[model samples]
Target: MLRDLAGAEWPRRAGLAALAAALGAENIRWVGGAVRDGLLGVAAHDVDCATTLRPEDVIAACKRAGLRTAPTGIEHGTVTVILKDGPVEVTTLRRDVATDGRRATIAFASDWSEDAARRDFTINALYAHPETLAIADYFGGLDDLREGRVRFIGDARQRIAEDHLRILRYYRFQTRFGAALDEAAETACADLAHTLKGLSRERIAAELLALLALPDPHPTIARMRERGVLGVILPEACPAQVAALARLIAAESAQGFAPDPIRRLAALLPPSPDVAETVAARLRLSKAQRTRLVNAAERTAHDSANAKALAYRLTPPLAIDRLLLEGADARGLDRWAVPQFPLKGGAIVARGVTAGPSVARLLQAVEARWVGEGFPQGERIEALLAEELAKRPQP
Candidate 1:
């Protein structure tokens, strides 16, 4: 039971206890990730609460209870309250009045069934009565949870039509549930994948990142590919990425590792950093994430081209991403010495070379000569440079 769910986290429990004391059984429990994780024996990350109180009332009561409150998603009747113990997000029950596959216009609904019906998945529709621990499943979410099944809260197609992002979420839960996916859910996803065109690029990016961030992204992505969403979003990849991902997963399995989503995303890329960066931009990855993945992809491409070149081209984090990419590809990557590119723009500029493309070309030539000389001593570098400069035609 998740709706108004209490976590095993002691601070969370204390907050729930205080909430029950403050509301005196008026709280309808919560219905989100916390309950799902608790049921799965996984640690909960975020907790959400559902209540009979309107958003304003939730804000006021939170103030009375001495918790800081903020409008995080008030447009959708959600408010975030800062408990001395931890932050809690509470939202009022609501029913979707209309949806055009990108966004929903909702109306406040006092009935739990109406709220439950509006939920995207059955596993999300269950609720617990804080006082009784009595789980409510107007949509058989508990049964689905037990069956390791991910089912839509109502008609699968209707639920997906409410939010195109739910198409991605349906597959995300595939890795979470470890269950046989419901056929109806898959069909709905296929039916609604085209509707994702209506969704904002930023929203699509966040959803995609979240999906990629999951511990087991490959399987879910495989499902997405099977459903045609993958090709539409990323035409670069084939099943090779999945094979590479499996090797990465197998090698890391015993480490009990937590993954870096950005690096993992690079492993999913084709040989092109341009393509990866473009996809990152389309999803509106934070500038930092976009930069990180782009760098990671670049390092991977270079390392794939030449193991020795990688050390010269990439720094530590990017090098790590590069090796991981190779490992994911089931390619061997042994370390090699990487000589520095030994030419400086300032030094080249001081050599009677003006600051323009010529200087850049001179630097490239110097570096190429240094590499060609088997990375010889400084005098050897000077000799080659002098020889090249003397042979150059006047520009």
Candidate 2:
């Protein structure tokens, strides 16, 4: 019984309105994330609806309404209807007919209750009538949402059996919503933790990154490690690093730093190139991400590297990642304050040097000294540049 949903305003959006008009107000309702977020007063990023109409019927209805439709996942009974405002995804009500702990073979169903029953979490199984704005809670999702509880709908073990990725998702949602874990859910997750191996690296990586994106996700991650769920997929993961991550996260919040999942992930692993590479391969991370992770590991391992020099060499983002991973005080790592090298190739050439490898070598030597002297300026930099020129062998 949700009241006054005008604050959500999503149901009034042109896309949803057109979708509702085409599918009939009673036959379609906002479902899944949109509905859950709406009831919680959080702005939803995507609007997904569940409808009694089948996929073909949905496409035809959208066409009749003069809305462009895309078969985003037609086999799965999902259509992306593009309206004046945005695209609203409408999925026909579905029930899992078979499952193998990783993938589910779903069959379209007309019964809302049957559709709700197949969902993983109660808090996510909510539905909202488009026009009336009345919420449909097939399970006790309303109570769970109000109480900050994350529970598997119906049976915990059965849900886990249906999809092992829910183990990671359980922690992710817990952290996101600030909800306490359901005891049965936790127990089921721990008992069936090995099933996570059957899941693809991409799924695990996506879920893990989402978990790390939450504010102060360290506590939940620590709990996952304790339950041996982290090790099930990332055997090389070091639980000890999460302690460092906790301190870094505190500093990040205090200094108004945005959340960084890659850096946070670095804090959870050992600082080894081989390990970083292996993890990247396992997770199928993009090339740029893999390079940054490996570079952070290598740079942080250099105990003698000055933080400023590191920032200059590895670029500020990579250097900061390294600094945080190695337990450097975030207060001291003012990367933006790192001074730029006062000399360039042109500066060296202006000092009576020809434009060749000789100029390049001279600039490299001077810049090395500048960085070595903590990026000196004025008289100090001039003196160093002069001395290097004198030693240039009169080219």
lDDT of each: 0.71, 0.82
Tens digits of per-residue lDDT, candidate 2, 145-189, equal 887888889899999999999998888888887456678988999
What tens digits encode model 1's per-residue C-alpha lDDT throughout 245-296? 6656654453334566676667677657788778787777888777777876
Q: What TM-score, over all chains together, does every model reach?
A: 0.77, 0.91
- Candidate 1 has its poorest 10 consecutive residues by lDDT at 328-337
> Which regions in candidate 2 have their CA more than 4 angstroms from the true location?
1-4, 301-307, 327-357, 372-382, 392-395
Q: Tell me, by lDDT, which candidate is best.
A: 2
